[model samples]
Target: MLKFDIFLSALANGLMTGAVYALIALGLTLVYGVLHIINFAHGATLTAAMFAVFVAHSVFKIDPYLAIVMLTPLFFGLGYAVQRFVINPASHGNDSNILLVTLGLSIIIENALLAGFRSDTRSIDVPYGFSVIEIGNLFLSTPKVVAFFASFVVAGLLWLLLARTDTGKAIRAVAREKTGAALSGINVDHIYAVTFGLGAACLAIAACLLMPTFLVNPRIGNAFVLVAFTIVVLGGMGSIAGALVGGLIIGVVESLSGLYFGESLGQIGIFLIFILVLLFRPTGLFGAKA
Candidate 1:
């Protein structure tokens, strides 16, 4: 009975953590879906957005949730500029060139953050940030609960945008085939920027939701980006729904592993599952063959 309770607790927490993980993976998958290049700078963008929240909290005494309104456009614009200026010019280059360029950008962003913010850790101090709710033998984190529900809401909205909107149709068209999309009158470059911006925008929302629970630092992106990658690959490189499901699965496995083995072994479980998936389904659970 005690063991079962522990399992339940772990499962509850895992789902909450997975919600945030899905949001992060959504951003990554979106960029990869359209650009055909992984944004290595994604983690840095997350780090930046978290730091932006910290700035709003410190300088203006604003709550992290509300800060999303101010930060989203800025983050979107940054994504737009990076795609338009840095990435677009290199679109004609090989995959290696694109990867190296984004990786370089990531390094620069991390180091710039290190120089600016120093090594000290920072975080928001909301009263309920660390609060917990109890149900029977299970305990749920308030922040995680909030972040989890918010992620679902955002996911639903994203689905609506993609399924029902014209701009969303343009983004999907480009993702399917750039040249084909261009021939059909889509401004491929413009759509690319918008897609990148949308991806970045998702990260901003995640950053704000996560700020209350996570510590801010230069290397913080390093902490979660690997998991984000795992989720992205496991779900499918370009599948948004797959990312969400993958995030939840990874989260549950991680939580259970930590409980039975140890915290360090949790990552091993992820790798094992990832390897199996690669062996059996290289295109991923949701990815379609080209």
Candidate 2:
């Protein structure tokens, strides 16, 4: 039988893990909400960011935390350029074209990483990598705790951006009605690029937070893609708060299920909830009725 204290500890761990998952889902949701395009390259972009952190650490002697400051804007710029120059031109306002372009981009990125770094799994040896916090009979990883809090901070800042900033308002306007937004003097294409950039920036931050605790390889980011999709769908297609709450809930469920059912089998719990959510609440927990 699992001890109550152990259960609590697992719950805590799940929340932390879910926070990162929320960050990943936030990027996906943002893009979907605004552009209405499912960015298949999102997972590859995340892998690229992880690799960016690793290279920054191993080659340039930068700390993972410190790399966040540098990588976030860099990724934002990359995403912007890709959306503006590559995806936009290639997609030509067609949904099928957009899907193909993003899917092709993902394949290109994955193969490029494979060719450059080979197939070896990589991780950094942070000075505080093994540090943990103890409270009562429970122990929590310090990196995870930091990630948990930082994820919320990022999400809050995102909310503030959307709720307060001019750029955010423009993005939201474009999301609601691009033709009206463009007629209102907003640069719709620029907004699309900006939204894509913001999504990539979120991934950069998530990657930095994950580096100390997670392993990285060319394919590592693919692991989060399905779960992120689940969170995005479960939270609703385009709801930010939904993504946050749904991620935490999924995290806890995954952790508890893992504890009782074992690690490999634990993943079934997430899909089960996903299926149930689809069958009963197709619009998702936070999604509006269509």
Candidate 3:
């Protein structure tokens, strides 16, 4: 049997990690929710954002936490322009074309990062990076705990954005029926861009939150992309709530699996559960049936 302290420690770690995972998945899921397409460039966008945070901290002397204020809108605008000009114009209403464009964009972004930053893995050293919160016998990393709470705040804000605002209503209308939304004078293309921007903005926030705890490289985001996709599928393709719940569950499972089976096999459990979810519940825990 596992020791109570050890198990509790793992569980706490899982939740903290899971919260950040959910934040990352929120971007991908939000894009899918509105655009109905898997953004192949999402992980790359995250990579870019992390680099932005890095640049802000190392060069501009802005704190990673403070970088959020600057980078989020910048990325949002970048996302908006990409969707408005590059993706929307090139795709011509075809899903496959959007996929290709995003894939191409990902390749370009990764290569740019490689050329600029090389393949070296970089990490930041904030003053509080080593700080931890002690509770009984458990010590939680401070950055991770802050990330945990911040994830909820972002999710809640996103929910309110979708539920309470006029833009949000327009987004929902376009998501549900693009033609009807357009006919109703809802500027579908603009809404599409906005949704995509929102997705990228989420990535910016996540990058900031993750920088203090995680390492960054051109390829680091790729490591999370598959896991994000799994969370997307597990929680339902377009279900925000599902993404949040699935992330936590996967985090816990990965933690426990790592504890028992070792690091190399830790990811196996995640995929196993993913496969089972696919086979048994293709619609996912919160997805609507097609």
Candidate 4:
């Protein structure tokens, strides 16, 4: 009975953590869908957004949620400019070059952050940071619940935006085929910028929502990127729904493994699962047939 209770607790926490992972993976998958290029700098961009929100709270005493509102447009512009200037140049015939450019951008951003922030850990000091609620035999942290719900809401909103808007249709067209989209009067380059901006905005939102629950450091993004990649692959490289389900599966697996096997071994087990998924279902659970 005690072991079962423990498993239940782990499951609850796992679900919450999985929601956070899903948000991150959604951004990655969005870029992949539109550009057909992996944005390796995604984690770095998320870390930067975290730091931006942290600064807003620390320096201006803004609420973290309010900080997200303020920073969203800022990051959107940054993303637009980045895609317009830096990424678009390399986004030519060579898709591999896009990967190389993003990888280089990640390194540069990480090093810049280390230089600026000195590799120190930081966190948002929100009122509900350590608050939790107990329901019978189970415990649930307030921040984790908030993160989970917020992630779902954001993801749902994104889906609606893509499914309902004119701009979204253009983006979808570009994602389906750039040259064809351009011939059909869609500005492919503009669509690319908008897609990248939206993806960056999602990362910023995720960073802000998660700030109170996790430590922020220059390298924190690195820790989550692999998990994000795993989620992406498991879901199907560019499938939004895949990211959601994949993230939840990983979270539950990690939670159960940690509860039964031990912490270090749990991570190893998750990686093993990732490997198996890659070997067996490289197209992912929802990935379109290639």
Candidate 5:
């Protein structure tokens, strides 16, 4: 039998890590739902936010958390403008073209970061980086706990915004059916911009929260982006709840695979699981039928 103690510890860590993955997948799903765009640039946007926080800490001596609060709105506006000027137009016709454009955007951002920061892995040195909380035989790192809680709070707020507010309802309407939303007097373009902006804002939030736990580098986003895509595919394309559940599921599976099968095969094992899910439930657990 599997040891209960070890399983509980692994489960805690998996859920905590999964919370971060869920945050990343949330943004991907939001963009896909509203704009029908895969947003290859989402990860790059997140890298940019991480770099922004790093700069604030290194140059201005500001707390990383405080810097995130200050920088989020700026990145949110940047996302809105990018969608309004570039992405929104391409979204209307030939989605492949839009995908290519975003791919180019991702390349541009990554290269720019390489040019500016070099190919070095950097981290924000926060005072709490070494802190942890222990309960019984279980121990939780402060940074991971914070990241997890922040993800939950952000997800909750997003849920409330979508379910309770008029703007949220408008966005939901557009996501469900753009033509019907337009017929009902919702400005489709504005809703699209808002959705993209919100998605990008979530990326910024996730980047900031995760920086203390992981090393920051231009290429780091590439790894997380792949995982995010897997989460989105497994959860059901454009399904928010699926993103949350799928992220946790993947995290636990990976943790267990690493413990039993070894780190090299862990990711491969997850991919195998993903393939099986596709073979059985092509639409994903929560995805709408294509």
Candidate 6:
């Protein structure tokens, strides 16, 4: 009975945490999907949003969740500017430039955050942040549950934005074939900016939702990037649905590994799964080879 209880507990916890993981990976997948550019700076974007939300909460007493409304637009603008000035200019050159530039950008952002935030861990305080709910033999962390729900809402809305909007159609067209999209008079470059902006905005949503659940610091990006990258590759680089499912799988496996072995072993388990996936299904769960 105790073993069964532990198993159930691990499963529940995994599902909750996995939801947020999926949200984090979603932005990464989207950017790569549309722009064909693997954004090595994605983790920096996550850290930046977390810091922005923390500052807003600290100075204005605004709810971290509420601050996402403004941060989303602000991030979108920043992303658009980045894509326009940096990524676009590099697009004309060798594809390797995108990789190197984004990698350098990530380092720059991390150091900037270290200077600004002083390497202290910061988090938002909320009334229900540490609360938990009991159902049968399971215990649910309140913040995790809330973050999970928020992730689902954002995911659904993103699906609509991609599937329904005319702008979305253009973005999809560009993703399918950039040259064809330009030939069709869709302004492929502008669509690239929009897609990058949308991806960045997704990070804001994920950061805001996570503010109550996790601590943020200059190294937080470094901490989570590995997991996020694994989830992205597991789900097939740009497939949103794949990200969601892959997150759940990774979460459960991680939880079980920690429960059975140890926390350090859990990290090894993640890589083991990642390696297996790469060997057998490099294209990923929902991704088709381009």
TM-score of each: 0.96, 0.99, 0.98, 0.96, 0.95, 0.95
Clashes of 1: 0
What TM-score would you give candidate 4 relative to the actual structure? Answer: 0.96
What tens-digit string does per-residue lDDT give for candidate 1 at 156-178?
88888988998899899898787
Measured with C-alpha atoms, the lDDT of residue 101 in candidate 6 is 84
lDDT of 2: 0.95
Worst 10 residues of 3 by lDDT: 1-10
**Best to worst by lDDT, what's the order?**
2, 3, 4, 1, 6, 5
- Name the better of 1 and 5 by lDDT: 1
Best by lDDT: 2
The 10-residue segment with the lowest total lDDT in model 4 = 264-273
What lDDT does each candidate get?
A: 0.88, 0.95, 0.92, 0.88, 0.86, 0.87
Better of 3 and 6 by lDDT: 3
Model 3, span 226-269: residue lDDT tens: 88999999999989999999989888988999988998998998
Q: Compared with the true structure, what per-residue lDDT tens digits does model 6 show for residues 1-290?
A: 98899899998888888888888888889988987878888899899999998989888888877888999999989988998898779767566788888888899999999999898888888888889989988889987888888888888988998899989899999988878888888998788888888888888888888888788998787666789889989999899999888888888889999988887887777899899999999989998895
lDDT of 3 at 11: 92
Write the candidate numbers in order of decreasing TM-score: 2, 3, 4, 1, 6, 5
Candidate 1 clash pair list: none
By how many angstroms RMSD does model 6 differ from the true structure? 1.4
TM-score of 2: 0.99
Candidate 4: tens digits of C-alpha lDDT, residues 52-170: 88899898998888877888889889998998899888767588988988899999998898999899899878898889989888889988988899989988988988899988888
